[model samples]
Target: MKHLSRLNKYFLKYKWWIIPGSIFVVISNIFGVVPAQVIGYAVDLITENVHVYNLFSGFNRQEIVYDIFSSNLLYFGLLVVLLYILRGLFLFFMRQTIILMSRHIEFDMKNDIYQHYQKLSLGFYRRNNTGDLMNRATEDVNRVRMYVGPAIMYTINTFVLSVLIIWSMFDVNSKLAIYCLLPLPFLVIIIYYVNTLIFKKSGKIQERLSDLSSFVQERFSGIRIIKSYVREDYTRNMFEIQSNEYKKDSMSLVKVSALFYPTMLLLIGLSTILTIYIGGMQVINGNITAGNIAEFIIYITQLTFPVTMLGWVTSLVQRAAASQKRINEFLDIPPDIQSKSNDETEINGHIRFENVSFTYPDTGIQALKNVSFEIKSGEFVAIIGKTGSGKSTMANLMMRMYDVEQGQITVDGQPIKALNLKNYRGQIGFVPQEVFLFSDTIKNNIAFGLDQVTDDEVFDAAKNASVYHNIIDFDEKFETMLGERGITLSGGQKQRVSIARALIKSPKILIFDDCLSAVDTKTEEDILQNLGKIMQGRITILIAHRISTIKNADKILVLDDGKIIEQGTHNELLSLNGAYTDLYNNQLLEEETKGI
Candidate 1:
């Protein structure tokens, strides 16, 4: 119950349905016992040809009023039919209202989880697998719904039915009731044991499902690599191994679940045996009529079903609790990065990283150490660094993907944290080294960031990125749908399309983090030529390894071993004849040799 309280807000939202549904559950059970009592009286009237009033008096009263219903089979039949009609009506309301509420709650919970996932920082995704998250969002949500819906409905039904039947049993014969109910405590002990096993097994089952889903997601996403490496058989065999493990765990859970029905039935059988034996003895001793014994037997049978349903309901509660725990773990995760203030301010793209030092979480190596730089508006600054020299880390920090551990990052003199994160990120256009495209049309991918973009604007951006010709060559042109991550396109084509995506945003700041690596040198130069014209007054930060790429920038900063070793224009760096000079000479020699 405590575990499920997290969803109280949703429950309260639909309490009108739940309250009325619960009333129907009680009402249905109250009238459901009528047919059994009526049958007992019918048997008594047939045996002695007595009036209904005589049977009601148990043939032990001195004064009995005869009525028109004497030996009346038709009247008893009509009464039983009316009682069942009422019971069926209440049953319909109970199932329709309560069960439907669960679906609504499930819908609400799934959206809530998805909305939360959208707000989580990038670092949270880095630590969790897609499959595990998907399972929590889908399967675990359904399990929790079972707890709030059918489990709750059945529990109420079982209580109401049990109370009604037990009272009738006591009215028939209190001694028989005592004997028949002796096994109930033992049933509780068994249910407790089953609940423990189910809780443990259900957790394992959900984990195995996540593993299987992860395996499938990875295989499908990397199908090209799998075929290129010729590891189809290996991948298939591994899938089978994972699938088999999931099957085994599921069967084990099923085996534990399978015990509940039989355990409840065993207790029910014992109770029934006690009822018959004691009930028959009471009748033989002339303590009660045969009708009383018949009614007692009917009440025991009625109690058997509700008692038996207890096992299933208990299992549902346990499984839901396990799922709730997994979901709560996700819901409880605090976002590592969030906007402290919602205040929005106009940004001029005047960025500064003042003595910023950052080490990645759980890593001993520092990604950035005392890094410091500034870029005024409209400056075409290029950052040159070898791999792992913190070039991308610098970009990530600028975008606020992760905050600095020391010092401050500011935009237009306002601390980055003080500005709203969404508004801050909206002003920057970033093209990362690894480009990702959705499985959608080319036009949609290009215009993804902007809420509204005209076809002319998309075409202009694509033309600027030098991808317009290639897109027109395709049969569907810009409407061509791509495969996962744009697998159908060439590497250079994908990079150009990604550039177009960033370009279409028309942002105040543009970042190209080694984005032109896959394109040929001539094409890269042409794209940069177009970009230079479009970036007249916008702050542009270009991260590249090839010296030729950033040779004509307004300023160049050389980073090595997490520090700024040199900063100058290309001509000034060449005149200094330092690290930048060495890199330029090596690249020049390689090109000259290639020409030969």
Candidate 2:
């Protein structure tokens, strides 16, 4: 219910529909009672020996009674039909309105969540699972939609109809009405307890469902690894365990729900029996008329429906509340990064790091410490390091993936933090180690960001990356679909396509984060040579492990444990005979043995 309160703002926007929907429901309930009243009157007339015909005869007692019965019965039947039709019409429109509103709200919620994810630091994604976020955006939103639609309307229907029936009963005979209501308080108590239990259990069920979805998603995404290691049987067993847990939780919920209808029936049965017993005695003792007793019985039967509906609506509301809580939890997490300025500034590609240091948010272990460097405009620099060194962190810092805690990083002598994020990001192009390509034509992937990139521009960039010939070899050429994440392409081809994407941006500063790892040495050399020719006046930062990749750079750095251990030209570092020199010697000897 508290979760539902948050929906008040959205509900307010659609109140124009909701208000009329409620009015129609009230009218339907009011007309719904008429048939019962008509039945009571007819029964009383028959018991009093009234004629079924001759209602048009002049001024006779029996004729008057017949007229009353005939006219009232006709009107009551017509009212019933009319209200039922109105109820259906209004309910259809109401559902449409509410569902439309829910969809809009869901859209807004998902967009906000996605936008928040974009603003968050990389560390946030490292700590969360992709499947859980997808579940929240998809399944949780659908649950909210159900609540706003049927759950809301049915709840209103139950309350309004129950009140109308009860008040009608009292109008007929207060004593009989009280006896009929004897079971109500207990029914309310049971519903209250059931709602509480449903909320707690449904929350657990949703969590297990999320875990199951995550398990399945993770396994499917890594199916290649599973097959490579011949772990299919093990993966199947793990999936079975997760599925069984989800099944057990769902069955428990079913068990709880199964009890609700029967308990409602029991209470309804008891209330009806008591109404007959007491009202029949009152009629026989002349304390009330036969019509009153008949009306009381009709009202008693009507009471059961709303009571049963109460249970149904209560269960739905509890499930919706549980879902709302999960959704709100995701929405409540503050982004780890926030853009502070919106003033756009032009970039000149001069980068400086002054005594900078940083640690990953969760681990608290320093990834980079007191590292400082400067790269002037148009310089080609390479960072070389062994695994576990701070090479990648330096590249990430340049892209502002995670901001440094100590000191400042400036581009063109202006602190990056002071510049607008969108403007700053536009000046740099990055090609990461992992290549991700959407399932689209090659041309679209290359021209993803630019509004109007000509085919010639795309082909020229691809030619520079040495992938244009391969693209033209395909049956569909540039229009060929790449399949999921470019699965159709070889690793080197995928890397080349990613490289072409970055090149198409024509950014002032280009970053290749171990981008050449997959390509052959010859292909890598050619691409580097072409890049060097075309990017003479642009800053280029290359992160690599191979000596061949960094040998031609103007300056090279050897990093270890978040600090620069050595920095110089390739020949100068080899002369030092340190970590870099040792690595170069091993690689040179290995290549010689292979007769390269």
Candidate 3:
């Protein structure tokens, strides 16, 4: 019922089609009853020796049996043909209408889920698998559409046809109808038990299927790495295990499905036998006419069909219910981060961290503790740290990926939480160590996230990042498609394209998080020099391991184990002779040795 309610709005939206569609189904079913009654009337006419024709005149006792048989046969044949045509027409329109409605509903639901996913916090994706999310948005949604499209209509048809058949049977012979319906209570009980089992097993089956999909997707995406390490056999074995488990679970569902129809048929067969024997006796005793007996048989057979359909419909409903529960569970998860304000505010890019502390949710270990920093607008700052030094955490916080537990981060004197999150993020641009580019044209990748930036502006941004020449050199120029993750481009080229993407945003605060590590030292130096000149009046924060990368910064902060161990300009930090000096000296010695 809840699943049906979930689809109510969509049904209502297309009610103009559905209402007529349902009416047609009813009309078709009603006409569908005519043949059985006609058969009964024909049998009665023959038994009574009544004339079927004198060319549409009233009953004539003088007419021959052949004339009666021929005339009634012709009438019955015509009636059957006309009714069948009407049934086909109704079925055609009904299917078309429901299919159209289901498609629209599925599309809208998928779009809504995708939009909601976009608004969800980064932690959601961090905890969920890409394949599982894909299944939810794709396979699960299609399941719902299947139910809405055919399962729902069939269920409704089964119900309506059952009621009409039973009612007509009662009118024909109440005692025989009661006899035929004796097994219904027991049938319902069995169906209820089977439905419960189906729902539970179907849920597990879907979850296992999701896991299987995830394994395959992960292995395919990392096939190169597996081959490089000669782990093909290992990967294949793992995939085989997952695939076998999926097959087992699916067969488990099939076991339940296979039993359902047979059990229904058993019950229906019992009801049919009871009706025939008892109704046959009544006809022999002259308590009911041969026509009524014929009509009762037809109704009994029709009753069994609905019972059979009910069992199948129950299975479909259970499957849909299980899928709905999974989808609802995903939809119910609230985002970890919530924005406190909706209004967009102008940012001057003055960032401040006052005694901030943070612990990752899954791992209770503190990633940052008592960290404090202040950077005025238009200052070029560099953060230098060894691995696991909380440098990335700082950048993540500025982007509001994870919220601070005990302290506040402010931009231009306003608490970041109190500003519109989208606007706040729009003012900052990031280039990470591992660049990600879509399998799209170079121009589109560079101009990503910009609503309407001019082509010339895009070219200029590419030129600033030292990637314009390479793009133009390609046969397709800016229109060249970069394969998955920009795999077609070299690591340095991918990084430069990422840099170009960030530069085109023209954000107030630019963060380059170890983005130049893959490039040659001379190219890195030139890129940094150009970026420094371009960011003269903006807040630029560089995270790097190389001393040359931070030597000209207005300020440099050295982080160790989530704490700032030192802070000063290049000469001042070198004079202090702490962690910064140790790193610089090590690098300087390595360079001299290479020179030697």
Candidate 4:
């Protein structure tokens, strides 16, 4: 229950529903416990000629009624029927309110977790798997909702009914009540141990479920690779192994749960048997009336349901607590990056990195070391390097995906940190080396970030990216739906659409992160030619492996081993005959050899 404290805020939000619902639960259970007393009084009316007035006065005085089918008997029977009707009504309203409140809370929790995931930094996603996070948001949230709904309703019903029924039994015969309830303390002790085991087992079950989910998600996502390499049997065997682990954990929980119900029933059955034997002995001795013994047995029978349900209710509570703990861990993690600044100034895209250095978290290798560069507004800068040479690292810092550790990056003479991240990133358009598109229409994918993009804007951007003709060739054209990650499109087509998506933003700064690698040389040349016109009066940074891609830029930077090895115009670097020259000569030789 203490683990449920995190939901206090939501409970407060929904108090209007919960408070009345709880009252109804009490009312319903109170009504549900009244039948035992009614039956006892009716028996007294028949056997001992005890009238209703004598029963309420707590006496066994004999008073004969003149008529057997009197108005009083009819009225008492009607009252019992009305009590049951009220019980049903109150139970209905209680379910309507509390159960619906649980659903609403589940909805809010799912939304909150999704929004929190959106706000979390890239590093958090890197640390956690998709299936684990998905399970926490969905399966774990549902488990918590069970605690707030059925578990709460049953627990309250158990307590209230237990109290009312036990009170009625004490009124009938205190000695009988004592003998019946003496075994209840041991039931509590049993529940205490059983619930602890349930909590432990439930956590393990959820964890194994998450592991199985992750395994399934990964295997499905990579099914193409599995089939391509003829590893279907291998993947299936791996899946079976994970499924068995989940099954073992589930069976362990089942074993613990299986013991709980029978144990509770045995204790409850023992108490009931003891009550009957003692009350019968008392009746034989004339210490208590037959009506009193009848009423005591009825109350104990009424108590049996709530007592037996104790084990199940405890399981729900313990399971919910375990799930809540998992969910709270996610909610408790502080994001590694946040936009704390309130500045709203528009950016002019004069970017500079001064003595910048960065190391990825949990990795000892430094990605960039004292690397620095400057690009004024309207300048075209190109970065050329081998793979893992900090080319993409610079672009990431520019986007503030990860902030620099040693030095500062500034835009328009303002520190990048001082600018709100959302606003800052909004002004720059980026196309990564590996393009990703949503499973949506081509037009929507192209105009992804921008709202209310017109047909002209979409067509013009597509043309500028040299992909408009390819789009129009399709029957549905821009309206054609794509498969996941645009798998229906060719590699070159995907890159072109990605470029068009970026171009549609009409940003003041554009970054091409080796975006042309998939396109043919002729199409690449045409795209760059159009990009030159679009790059006018806007900062452009090109990151590429091809020497031909960056040769015409106003400035070219060559990097190696996380350090900038050379910086000059293409002709100047060619004259220097250093790292840049070596890369150019090797590429030119490859082209010549291929021509042969």
Candidate 5:
């Protein structure tokens, strides 16, 4: 309830719909109960007519009495039908008002949740699984809508109808009404018990559902690996185990739910019995008419459905609260990284890192140590290092994906963290080592970084990346759509497309982080030559391992472990005959032996 109480704002936001819908509930119930009185009246009039007919044995007199009774019954029947129609009309109005509001609220909440998700930092994603995130956004939000729509609507309906029905019963015959309602307190006790059980189990069921969803998502994403290992049967068995556990938990809940309705019916049946037996006795004593007994029964029957719905409404609310709690957990989290200032300062070519040190928080592994370097205007600097030597870490720092622990990174004599995050990153064209492309057309993929781009711009970027001819050869040309992660494209083609995406941005600083590894030397050289035409007045940092890739760079820094061991021009590094020389010679030997 505390978690559900957090949704008061939505209620207030849609109060106009709710307030009118509540009035309609009351009005509809008023119309709904009027027919019971009409039926009772018809019963009394018929009884009187029959008694009069019994007193006169003449055939013509009996016929006249029968005619009067038929005419009276028809009038009452028409009135009852008219009342029912009125009730139904308001019911429709009720749904249009309240239910429609729920849908609107659902839309707003989903957007809010998604917008918040996009603001969270990389560390948050690393800490949470995709299944849990998706469950909260999709499945959880859907359950919350049930509470807002059906559960709440039914609750109000049950309350209003119960109040009206019980009041009418007591007004006609207080003593009989008390007996008929004797089973109600017991019903309350059972609903409380069911609510407790459902609240407890609902949370567990959702957690298990998240687990199941995550398992299926991850396995499907890696289905190719499963087939490669020839372990489809193993994966199927694992999925069966998960599905069986879900079924078991769900059945346990269903078993509890099964107990609820039967017990409810038993109590309802008891109420009906009391109305009949007790009201019959009252009629014998002349305290009430038999017609009144029929009326009490009709009233009890009307109340039956609403009272029975209490258990279902309780279940919906419990599930909704559990789901909303999960959603709120994500909503309440503040991003670990955000811009400290709104200043969208222009980035110059002067980028510097002073005594930077950092560790990956998730793993607590030190990725960089006292790394200091500077890139002046139009400098083409290449970083070469072994795996885990912090080559990628430097690129991450430049992008401000994470902040340094010991020192500061500055752009144009300002702390990088102080700049607006969006504006700062917008100027840097970064092609990560692990390339990713959306399942979209080739032209759209190339121009992904921009809001709008012309066909000529897309072609030019593709040409600069040396993939223009490959794309033009496709049957769909630029319109050809790729599969998931661009799986339809070959490795080299995928890398080239990623480069084109970065190149299309027309950035101030270009960081190509080992993105050319998939392509051969000839294509890589062609791409670099094409890039040179537009490389003026922009700082370029290339991180790669192959000596041939960085041989013509203005400067090269060799990293060993987390520290820089050597920094010089390509010729100067060879003269030193250090780590750089050894790496260059080994690659040169391989190329020569292969007759390249």
Candidate 6:
């Protein structure tokens, strides 16, 4: 109930719909009970006419009977039909209002969840898996919608119908009504006991579903590796096991859900027997007429459907609460990374890391330690390091993917956190080592950084990244849409397209994190030369493993195990008998040995 309170705002938002829907529910239920009363009245009218005719009528009685009963019966039957037709109309309006409101709420909720997903920092994604997140958004949301729409609708119908029918029954004879409704308190007891089990099982079933979804997603995403390793049978068996687990949990929930109908029928059956047996006695004792017995029977019949719905509605509320709790778990978490400043900071092409240090929140592995560097405008600064030596971490910090734990990063002498986070990121174009591209056309991939771009600008960026020729040779050229993550392109082509994406932005600060690793030497050199021409007024930081790539850089920083070992020009680093000198010689020998 507490978790579901989060949806109250949405209810308030769509209050107009609910108000009319409630009115329709009351009016419809009113018409609903009136027809039952008509049925009872007709039964009495026919019974009294037959009794009077048998006692005092003669041979011409058939004609008299037809004249007296015909008009009266016809009028009652027509009136009953009209009442039902009116009820049906209001029912339609009720659904249109309440169910439609639920759909609108579903739309808004999905948007809110997805919007929050985008705002969350990288660490949040690390803490949660994709499949669970997807399940909460899709399956859990759908369950909640059931509660809002059909469950809510039926609940109101049941309450209104039950109250009117029970009141009418007691109005005729309080003792008989007690006998007819004696089984109801037991219904409440059954609901309370079953609710706990249903709620628990519902949560477990959803968790298993999330697990199965995650397993399938990973298997498909890594299908290539699975085939390459010839592990098809192993993967198949693994999936079978997970699928069976999901089936087991689902069956448990199904079994609990199946219990509702039988139990409901038994209680309703008991109530019917009690109504008939006690009302028969009342008629015999002359306390009430046979007509009243018929009315009591009709009232019980009227209450049957709503009473049956009690179990169904209870299960729905429980499941909805479970799902709502899961959804609230994510919604409650405020994104840790937010911009404090309202205005975008002006770019001055100067960046400084003043004793900055950071540790990965997911693993707590310190990736940088008291690192400090400064980049002036128009400088081609390169960072060289072995794997896991914090070169890429520097780029991540500069991009503010994770805030520094100690010290500060300043852009144009202003603390980076003080700048508007979105605008600050917008000014830098970063190409990570692991390139990812959307399934989109070649032109759109290159121009992805900008909201609007000219064809010539896209072409120019592609040319600079040395992927223009590759794209043009394709059948659809720039209009060719790639597969998921741009799997249609070769490794080098994908990397180049990624670089082109960054270059298209023409940003004030550019960071390339060894994004050219897959390209051939000639293409790499061509791309570098193109970058040199564009580097006139930008701060370019290149993270590289290849010594040749950074040999001509204006400044080079050597990193070893999360700390900078040396910083100087490429020639100046060679002059020192240090780690940088040894790495350069080793790389140079490898190139020579390969006949490069």
Best by TM-score: 6
lDDT of 1 by residue, 492-523 (tens): 99999999999998889999999988999988
Two-way lDDT contest, 3 vs 5, winner: 5
RMSD of 3: 2.9
lDDT scores of the candidates, listed in order: 0.89, 0.83, 0.85, 0.88, 0.90, 0.89
User: Per-residue alpha-carbon lDDT of model 6 for 1-596, expressed as tens digits?
Assistant: 88889889998999999999999999999999888778778888988878766765666876687678888899999999999999999999999999999999999999999999888888899888888999999999999998888888999999999999988888888999898888889888888898999999888888888888888888887888999999999999999999999899888878877887788788888988887888899888988777778777777777778877878888888899999999998998998788888896658668898898889988989988998888888889999999999998899888888788899998888888888888988988999998998988988888889999999999999999999999999999999999888899999999999999999988889999998799888999999999999867788999999988888899999998899889999889989979989998898799889995
TM-score for predicted model 4 compared with the true structure? 0.95
Q: Could you tell which candidate, 3 or 6, scores higher by TM-score? A: 6
Candidate 6 backbone collisions, by pair: none
* Best first by TM-score, ranked: 6, 5, 4, 3, 1, 2
**Per-residue lDDT for 1-596 in model 3, tens only?**
57546767778887886787677668767776777787788678766654334443543544565566778778877887887788778777777777777788899889978987887887788778988988888888887887887787787778778878888888887888899888889888888989899888888888988998888889887878999999999988998998898898889888987987888788778887887799889989988887877777787777777787787788778888888778887888887777878887778899999999988886677878899999999999999999888998899998898999988998888887888888888888899877999999999999996989889989998999998998899999999998888988999999999999999988899999999888888888878888888887899999998988889999999999999999999999989988999999999999999999
Name the runs in model 6 displaced over 4 angstroms: 59-62
Q: Taking the candidates one at a time, how many backbone clashes does each contain?
A: 0, 0, 0, 0, 0, 0
Better of 2 and 5 by TM-score: 5
Badly placed stretches (over 4 Å) of model 5 are 59-62, 593-596
Judge candidate 1 against the unseen true structure and give its global Cα lDDT, from 0 to 1. 0.89
Q: With candidate 4 superimposed using the best TM-score fit, by how many Å does residue 348's alpha carbon deviate from the native?
A: 0.7
Provide C-alpha RMSD values for all models, in order.
3.8, 3.0, 2.9, 3.8, 1.8, 1.4
lDDT of 2 by residue, 1-596 (tens): 87767777767877876787677666666666766777677677666545445553566676667777677667656765775676667656656655565677667667866776677778877887888878877787777777877777777777887888888888887888899889888888888988999999988888888888889889988888999999999999999998898899888888888998898889888888988899889888887878877787778788777777788778888888998898878667876556689887767799999999988888898888898888989889999988878888888889888888998999889887777877788778788888898899999988875779999999998998999999999999999998778888999999999999889888888999898999998889889998898778989999998989989988898899989888888889989989999999999899999996
lDDT of 5: 0.90
lDDT of 6: 0.89
Candidate 4, residue 110: CA error in Å?
1.0
Q: Which candidate comes out best when scored by lDDT?
A: 5
Residue pairs in collision within model 1: none
